[model samples]
Target: MSAPMPTGVHYHQRSRELALTYDINGESQSFRLGAEMLRVYSPSAEVRGHSPEQAVLQTGMKYVGLKNITPVGNYALKLHFDDGHDSGLYTYAYLWEMIENRELWWDDYLHELKKANASREPLGIPLQRQ
Candidate 1:
C-alpha cells in the first residue's frame, strides 16, 4: 500500500538468495529474491545504462551468488556478487520496484534468451565451497 520499511535483510551464501522482510501498512511481509534474479536485474549503469535503448542484457549468470552486502549510509546497499559484479547500488525503493516487476522482467528475460538462442547456464561449472 505504501513504501515498505525494511526490517531485515539477509543474504544466504549457500543458496545464493536474499531474504527481505519489510513492514508495509502495519503488515510484515517476507520475500526471497534469488541471486540470478538480482544479478540479471542489476541497476548498474553497465546493466541498465544511461538510457533504455543502451541497456545490456546479462547472460550466463546462473551461477552468480551473493558474496557480501554493505549498507550505503541508510539509503542503499552495495551488493558484492560472487562473479565480480559489485557496482550496482540497490536502494530500498529499487528493491521494492524489483519485487513489483519481478514477474514481467523475468518473462521478458526468458523471451530474450530464447530469441537469442542463449542459455542461463554458465560456461563452466561452479566449484562448491566448503
Candidate 2:
C-alpha cells in the first residue's frame, strides 16, 4: 500500500518543527515533527550506513536545524540540515512511518544513547564535552 500524499508541508524555523498535513481516508491529519527527530532518524547513508549493522548513532544533534528542503522528483524530499548533512532522501512513506512510530523510535534512540554513553547535546559544547 502506498502512503497518503501530503496535502501541505511547512517548516517553522523558530520552533524547529516540520508541520506536515496529509489526507487519509478523506480525513486531514497533521503532525508536528521536531528537527532533532528528523536529523537523528535521517534515512541517509551517512546515518543509516551501508547496512543495519553499520548504522551510525547520531548524537550531538540536539540543536540541529533545517537549512533547506528540496523535492526529489515526486516521491521524496532532500533535506539539508544545518549541521552540514544533506544526503538524506526522506520519502513520504518513510516520513509517515516516522510520524506514526515516533514514540517507539524515540525510545529506541534513548536506548541507543544509554548503551553508548552518549549525550544528545550539541557537538562541541564545552559543558557537554565534560
Candidate 3:
C-alpha cells in the first residue's frame, strides 16, 4: 500500500508544535508533533549515524524548536532547527512511524538518558570569578 500524502502542514509558533494533516483509508488524520521531540529524533546522519551502535545521543534539547521546514522533492521534508541543524530528511513513512511509535521511542530515549546519566537541560555558561 502507498503511504498517505500530507494534505497540510502547519507550524504553531507559540506552542512549538507541528500539525500534519493527511487523508488515509478514507479518513482524515492530524498529528501534533512537538519541536523538542522532532529535534531529538532527527534522521540526520549527524544524529542517527550510519549504524545503530554509532547513534549519537541528543542532549540539551529540552527546549529546542523548529526554525523552518523545506520540502525535498515530493517524498520528504528538510527540517531546519533553531540550533542550526538542517540536514535531516523526514520522509512520510518516517513521520508516520514516529507518530505511531512515539511512546515506545520516547521510552527508549529516556532509558538511554538514564543509563548514560544524561540531562536534557541545556548547558549553562560558566561564570568567571573575578
Candidate 4:
C-alpha cells in the first residue's frame, strides 16, 4: 500500500532552497528541495510525457537557473525556468518523491545527459541580473 498523504505543512525557505515538512495521518514526513534540483526535474509534459521519445533532453541547464517560483495551490507549484519555460505544475507528491529518491533521479539525469554527450554546465553562459 502507498504511504498515507501528508497533513500538516511547513516550508523552510533559504536564500536558494526550500524544505518542506508535513504529517500524513500522523506519519511525519519531510523533503529538502533545492531550486536547481526542482528546475531540473520538472514534471510537465514538456519534460515527462507526450511519449518517451518525445521527451526533450534538457542540456546546458546547469546555467538555465531559476527566475521565480509561483504557488499553484497548496499542493503544487509553477516554476519559471531561466531558459523561459513556465508551463510545469509540480505537485507536492511529485516533489516529495523527487526529494526522497534524489540520488537515483540525479544519477539518471546525469547518465542520460552523458549518453547524449550533453553537458550539465552551459557553454558561453550569459550572466543573470541580480
Q: Stretches of candidate 1 above 4 Å error?
A: none
Shift of residue 118 alpha carbon in model 2, Å: 0.3
Candidate 2: list runs displaced more than 4 Å. Answer: 126-130
- TM for every model, in the order presented, reads 0.91, 0.91, 0.90, 0.74
The better candidate by TM-score, 1 or 4, is 1
lDDT of 3 by residue, 1-130 (tens): 5567698898887787889999877888899888888888999889999998888999888767788999889988888988899889999888888888888988898898889999788789533322
**Each model's C-alpha lDDT?**
0.87, 0.88, 0.85, 0.69
- List per-candidate RMSD values in Å: 1.4, 3.5, 4.6, 3.3
Candidate 1 lDDT tens digits, 1-130: 5557579998887788898898777888888888999998999999989999888888898878887899998778889988899999999888888888888988999998999898888877767765
Q: lDDT for model 3, on a 0 to 1 scale?
A: 0.85
**Per-residue error (Å), model 3, residue 3:** 3.0
Q: Tell me how far the alpha carbon of residue 79 in candidate 4 is from the true structure, in angstroms, after superposition.
A: 1.4
Q: Poorest 10 consecutive residues of model 1 by lDDT?
A: 121-130
Pairs of colliding residues, candidate 3: none
- What's model 3's lDDT at 129? 22
Q: Give the RMSD in angstroms, all C-alphas superposed, for model 3.
A: 4.6
lDDT of 2 by residue, 1-130 (tens): 5787688989998888999998888899889889999999999888999899989999988777888999888889888998799988999999989988999999999899989999898656533220
In terms of TM-score, how similar is model 2 to the real structure?
0.91
